[model samples]
Target: MKNNWQLYVLILPAVIYFIVFNYFPLYGIQIAFKDYKAASGIAGSAWVGLKHFENFFNAYYFKRLLSNTLLLNVFNLLWSFPIPLILAIFLNQIKSPKRKRFIQTSIYVPYFISTVVLAGMLYIFLSPTSGIFNIMRTSLGMKAVDYMSEAAAFRTIYIISGVWQTAGWGTILYMASLAGVDTSLYEAAEIDGASIWQKIRYIDLPSLVSVAMMVFILDCGKLLSSNTDKALVMQTAGNIPTSDIIGVYVYNVGLGSGQFSYTAAIGLFVNLINFILIMSVNKLSKKVTDVGLF
Candidate 1:
């Protein structure tokens, strides 16, 4: 008991954080089942049961909102999920430590740029007139197109910019995991006359599986979640259909339109789904690889 005291002390801060940031806010979820009025506050709010939930389920925007959120998540899963693995593998193959550090530093710079600044830069670069992209199009005798206003381009821009900003930062964890892989495995593979590709395929990839699965599970849990600020900053009326993800939709309902109860209900539902996804993925991971967050 005396020896375990330090471990409890180490966990005290996280326990406090969850109490303050997570458990306390659970009381507010009741607002979803009430006709909440800011003047009356949460305690005095009139209970309406599942009225708000029903409203959201039957709302005209339900299908579009759900479709947009799921599609964006799918796109992220398909495209963004594997990038760090590939980057980490390629970066690990570089023999020069100095050159590797330089490349990593350069790649990581984009992640530190504020979302507002990054979105502004994207807008300027993709603008129809006086933008470099359009200028190049015109130079090539093609018509200059306004990419920011185009629905088809919204997902492309969001995914590509997201990859540019986060891929390097993501690689850091995978690279660390790769570094911890036993060098003896590689030596054994080489002694067995395994080619470099075979060494990577049989040895390096297996070592990466646990880290990769953990990351994938985390990503899946956030499938319907996004940063409202980034989405709003990048959104335009013309591209709203493509860019209006769950976070932005919630922001619009609660803060923008004052549909507080409805937004609460929707947000609660989204969080529940996320929770289920995390649990399911964790269980599956345990079954498949004998590794899980639990």
Candidate 2:
């Protein structure tokens, strides 16, 4: 310990951060089982074990919220997971460093945009009256449609926008994995008269297996969660049928309506489900592919 004192000192901030922000907040999780009065505080709150969970289970919007949250994430995972892999593969094949760097930078720029700003951009670009899309449709002799308000289009828009924003940034890990590939392997493939597609299939994809599995396992853990702020901002009266997810519900009824205990219960329930899902996925992945986060 004395030999690595500087190393430990460097890590102290991260340790303290987790302790203060992550571990300390766990103390308040008991509120999920309590009535959680503001005057009573967390420890003083009246215990009402499972009451909030039961109420939420019986709520009319329960099924819709669960389905919406699950479907949105499932669709997002399906769409967003592969684009980055493909981009990384294609980027790896780019031999010119300058061209590759420029493309990589261009693609990564969108990920830096804030969720609220992206949502506002969506609103502006999809505005039924003055939006460019509507204008283009009108020019092409088509009816203008309010995409943001269309419940049928909600998931598609969400998934597409999320992919656009994140796919490039997501390539970082895969690109790193690819960068570590032995140059000799490519040389050997070339000597064997292997084509680019064949080389990618035989070399690149296989090398990415472990990393991909870890990424998939992590993504599965978020199956029941969504970005609340983005969804909340994008939500509209017409799209509530599809856009009303558990996070938004928790935000509204928990903070807005002052039902802290109720929302905490919902949050706990979602966390438990996510935990079960991630564990199940990790176990199955380890069993089948011999690669997992564990």
Candidate 3:
């Protein structure tokens, strides 16, 4: 420990930053269990012993919130997560290096676009009045529809746009792992008269099991969350029923309404679920794969 002072010095700032910004605020977790009041502040707030959590659990909109959050998360996990793996495989198979780079670079640009801008773009394209989508619809002799305002289209747009924005960035790890596959394996498969599908299924796919398992397990931790920034920007009274997930709910009841104790309780519920899922998934990954991320 004494000999590693230089390395410790290099990491000291990050360590302190987490302590200051993350761990220190944990003291306010007590607010969730208290009938917090501005006059008394967090420390002096009267202890209420799970009242907020109880209220939230029994709230009229509880089912809606839970369903919406879970659906979005599951949709993302199933569709968005796997697209990157497919993309990486496709990119790896490209014979032309210049064309491959151009395609990869093009896909990656969407990930760098800010969430706010992405939402705005969706609005602009999906708006019924002047959006390109409606213009094309009307030109085709169909009624101009407000896609963003339709509850049914909310999840579709949200999930598809999320995939569009993130799938490329997500390819990085899979591509790296794919690059590490043994060239000898391919040569042997070639000699054996293996088809492309056979090579991918038996070789490349097996090589990705560890990485895929880890990514799947980690992604499960966010099953109760949604992209609050994008959701908030896209949310409208028309789409509120479908768009209101835990993150947006927390923002509304917590900061928007200033119900600190109630919001804290909701947040605590979210984090607790995430922690439990992470632990459970890690244990499952250990049983199913050679490498577990614990």
Candidate 4:
């Protein structure tokens, strides 16, 4: 028991952190089931049971919100999930240490750029008036289109920007995994007259499978979330129909309109879905690869 005391002491900070930032906030989940009035406060708020959740479920925007949220996640799963893996694999194949370092540094730079700055850059680049894109359009005898106002263009812009911002940063984990791979495997493949493609398929890919699965599971857990800051920056009245994701919706309801309890219910619902997805993916990963965040 005395020996175990030091271990508990070491974990004290982490336990405190979860209590303060995570577990404490969970008490507010009750807001989802209450008519939470700021004047009345949490204790004084009327218990409304499932009324707020039922309201959200029956809201006119429910279908559109669900569709937009699911579509964004699907696009992210399809396009964003594989980019870092491929980038890591390609970067690993580079034999020159100097070139590898340079490539990694260049790619990760975009991630450090503030979301506001990045969105502003996008707006400038896609601007219809006095912007490079529009200038090129006119030179090519094409119509100068306002991309920010177009519903069809919102998802594409969001996805592409997401890839550019995160793909490089995401590769760091896979690169670390690749670094731990035994060089003897590659040497043996070479001695067996295996082609580069075959070596990658059988050796590199297998080595990376666990890392990839972990990343995929983490992304699945965030399937319903979009960065509210970035979405807000990109959003305009004209683009809201397509760009209004769950996070953005919560921000609008809670902060913009002061519908605190309503937003809490919606946010809680989104988080519940995320929790289910994470558990589901974790279970599948454990079965398939014996690696999971237990």
Candidate 5:
């Protein structure tokens, strides 16, 4: 232990980071059970026990929020989850280093775009009057559609844009796993006259099983959380039916309406839900595939 003091020194900053930023803020969680007031402050606030939680559960928007959040995340996962894996597999087959790097760079660039910028681009490109998408449709003898304002289109747009932005970045870990595959395996497969698809199915897909399970388990933790920034900016009066997700509702009610205690209770509820989800998924993954984040 004494000889490894320098190693401990290197980890001190990360330890302190979790302590300060993650653990310290837990003290405010008590506000969820109290009738918090700015004048009374957290310590002086009167305890309300489960009143806020009950109110949230019975609220008119309760079902809508829960459904919207779940549906959005579930659909997003269904559509976006497989693209990166497919991309990584095919990318591994690319023999031209130059072409692989170029394609990788092109796809990865969108991930660096800020949420706000991406939302703005969506609005510009989907504009019914001037947007290129609508322009092409109109040129083809079809009426223009205001896609951003269409409630039914919200999830589709969100999921598609999300994939375009982050699919390449998500491929990083899969690519790393593929990179570690022994060249001898490929040599043996080629000598056996195996096709690319056969090599990918038998070699690449099997190698990705553990990593894919971990990613899936982690994603399940966010089943009730949506990208509030993107959803908020893209929201319109017409799309409110589908776009009023729990995260946006929380932000609006919490900061916009200053319902501190109520929002705190909601946040705590969501955190508990996510925690349970992650734990359950991890256990299930372990039982089924012997791969888990823990």
Candidate 6:
């Protein structure tokens, strides 16, 4: 530790930031067990034990809320996780450096597009009256349909849009990992006249598994959290059941109803679930591949 004193100094600010902003706010978690009042504040709020937790668990919408959150995460993981790995492998294989770099840059542009703008674009592209999808359908002599109102299609739209936005950035991570792989393996494969597919399968894919597992585990840690901004922007009255995730639900309950104590309890609950997910996945990773964040 003493030998790397300068390196430790570099990380001190980030350490302090997490302690001050993240760990310190945890002291207010007690508000979840209390009937918090605005004037009284957290410290002065009367302790009500598990009243808020009980209320949340027994609430009429509890199952629907939990199911929607789980479904969104599950479908998202299934569709979005592998795409970056596939795209990264393709990016890594491109012999022309200029073309590869240009393609990578082009794909990443979508990620920086604001969620509100992306959601608006989706509405425009899927609008029954004048949308591109309906326009194509009209050219085929087919009827236009309201895609945004289709609850069954909501999950697919959300997942595909999310992947389109973030997959390119994720590909960069895997590509970086692939770059560190020993060049001798590829040279040896070339000597054996190995096909590109063979080289990718035997060399590139194996090297990516460790990094991919870490990324997967990190994502699993956030299974209970849905990004509120994106969900809210994409949401409409018609797709309430499909789009209302835990984060959105908490925002509505907390600020919309001013139920501070109840919201605190729900936040704590979500954090606990996230914690369990990360721990469990970490253990499984160690068991299967003998590798993990720890």
* Candidate 5 worst ten-residue window by lDDT: 77-86
Whole-model Cα lDDT of every candidate shown, in order = 0.89, 0.96, 0.91, 0.91, 0.95, 0.93
Per-residue error for 202 in candidate 4, Å, reads 1.0
Clashing pairs in 5: none
Candidate 6 error regions (>4 Å): 1-4
When summed lDDT is taken over every stretch of 10 residues in candidate 2, the lowest stretch is 36-45
In terms of lDDT, which candidate is stronger, 1 or 3? 3
Residue 235 error, candidate 4, Å: 0.4
Clashing pairs in 3: none
lDDT of 6 by residue, 1-294 (tens): 999999999999999999999999989999999999989988898999999999999999899989999989988998789999999999989999999999999999999999999999999999999999999999999999888988777889999999999999889889999999999999999999999999999999999999999999999998888878998888888888788887888889899999989999999999999999999999999999987999
In each prediction, how many residue pairs overlap at the backbone (N, C-alpha, C within less than 3 A)? 0, 0, 0, 0, 0, 0
TM-score of each: 0.95, 0.99, 0.94, 0.94, 0.98, 0.97
Model 2 lDDT at residue 187: 100
For residues 43-143, could you state the per-residue lDDT of candidate 4 as single tens digits? 89999999989998999999898898889878978889999999999998899999999999999999999999999999999999977989999999999
Task: Write one digit per residue (lDDT tens) for candidate 1, span 152-271.
Answer: 888888888999999999998899998998889888887899987887798778889989999999998988887668878989989998888878988877898998988999999999
Sliding window of 10 residues with minimal summed lDDT for model 4: 69-78
lDDT per residue for candidate 5 within 84-110, as digits (tens), equals 999999899999999999999998999
Candidate 6 colliding pairs, count: 0
The TM-score of candidate 2 is 0.99
Could you give me the TM-score of model 4 versus the true structure? Answer: 0.94
Which consecutive 10 residues in model 3 have the weakest lDDT in total?
Answer: 285-294
Q: Where in model 1 is the C-alpha error above 4 Å?
A: 4-7
